[model samples]
Target: MTSKYEIRLNSKIDIRRIYTNETLPLRKKVLKPFLTEEECINPGDDLTSTYHFGLFQENKLISISTFIQEGHPDFLSTFPYRLRGMATDTEFQGQGLGGILLQHGVEYLRQKECDFLWFNARIKAFPFYEKLGFSYYGPLFDIKDIGPHKVMYKILIPK
Candidate 1:
């Protein structure tokens, strides 16, 4: 079931204009790990501090990830913590595009001298993040609409 799709590090990507139709498919894919459709959409609607990446197939937007900056406010992180939209089109799942986006984000984070990278990973996806060297911190937290999530973080060793 191979399809013509590609994942690239897109700097010009924007989250704001993504139409619901284009965004919905990826949301469905993420439901396995992130059950809240609204969490996927909220950051896109009002992006205060986030970076964007796009997944495309022949010029069509198929998936997106949003990296939100997080850290102690007084500390003002050199490396921003991120919460990813991490949605892939139903047709594009299991093709390793999510890893591509995550790698790309880490490269950028590395350049910024980030001390840590964190995300609320769904229980099903904990192993995925673990493969990336992110360790779980604290107990799982419940989202009113999305069930439980494990907080995972990777401490970036200085290069």
Candidate 2:
């Protein structure tokens, strides 16, 4: 049996454009608690072409990801977007909120004619990204203070 509270929360999930500052709390809590607030900020976070997205359940921000107009040297696409700092609250981790938010961002980029989307996905997250159609692009590498990661990419067929 579902309670009224559960119904309300399930019915009110929303994904929308958010400011960079709005993503810091979840990112810090879920992705990098060891880093300071300043270190949680990604490069290009303030750029005009950069966008931040958040998923909210009844106004509580639970999932976040940032997209920036950055290209990889190995990829030949003219317009490539990089996904950064994707995180979801611990309580909401397995509910597919992150996938929902990512798909929303992909649709937005497709509308904007982005050629491809890519990111350095953490080792433990490979299966999640793979299930979403992202392919591994490079060999494993490690970021300082962070664990292993691999470049993953998805080609966007423009809508």
Candidate 3:
């Protein structure tokens, strides 16, 4: 016997553009736990073309991801977006909130005429990015003690 099922959340979530300061603690907690909050701040985070998206439930910021107008050195495009500092609160992990954040983030970038979004995805998080239509390129490399990572990109094909 075989069966398939799904559960849709009718719950309301606010996907909003948030300031970088609003994202630091969650970024430190989820992404850069071993380092100081100062270490979690990425290079292009303060750029005018960078946009940080946060998922809020009942006014509590739960998950966040940043999109910047930085192209992958390998993937050339007029407006390639780089996805950075994506993190969901540990308490809310495995509930599909990360997927929601990516979906909304992609749409927002597409409207700005971005050709694609790319990032250095962690090995453990590879499956999650794959599910959202991102593919990998380049050899496996490392960041000091942060483990291995590969460059992954998702193209927003025109409809």
Candidate 4:
């Protein structure tokens, strides 16, 4: 199944709150092909505080991410949140939609006065997260068969 690409580079992509299940398609196609769709459902996804954010272009969900209220063992914060299951549709990669999605999702944490956000980012996407002001710490690590990953986090400010 493929989504039709009807939006141009300058078009505004809609970033919206989505349900946990809505993230499975992109998660399966981009991040977890080795696992079944049912397996793509990440742990804690159904938790009351867990949130899913999706990027839509031409009404097609092109990028998705999951956020949970969890803290990094080495990082201390009042309300530490973790981001996971981030995937951008291959066709929509390099279009800056991922950053836009992050900016939108960060607002949620900002509203809740979260102290920081952290995630294990794939090494290849380290620069992308860096561009969004996230700092990488610790050494590169592997997530099972998912290649190299490193811990990244950003401090949040509440207004």
Give the candidate number with the greatest lDDT. 2
What candidate 4 gets wrong by more than 4 Å, as runs, is 1-12
The stretch of ten residues in a row with the least summed lDDT in candidate 4 is 1-10
Compose the digit string of candidate 4's lDDT tens values, residues 1-159. 223312233455666678988998889999989998889997899998888888888788999878999999998899888999989999999988888888777877788788899999998898899999999889998899789999999999875
Name the lDDT value of residue 104 in candidate 2.
Answer: 83
Tens digits of per-residue lDDT for model 3, 2-88: 112112234566677788888899999988889888888899899999998888776788999898888877776878899999999
- Full ranking by TM-score: 2, 4, 3, 1
Better of 3 and 4 by lDDT: 4
* Model 2 lDDT per residue over 1-159, tens place: 343212222568877678999999988898889988788998899998998888889789999989999999998997899999999999989888899889888988898999999999999899889999999987999988788999999999888
Stretches of candidate 2 off by over 4 Å are 1-10
lDDT of each: 0.60, 0.88, 0.84, 0.85
Off by over 4 Å in 3: 1-11
Q: What is the Cα-based lDDT of residue 106 in candidate 3?
A: 88
Local error of candidate 2 at 103, Å?
0.3
C-alpha TM-scores of all predictions: 0.67, 0.92, 0.90, 0.90
lDDT for residue 65 in candidate 3, whole number 0-100: 89
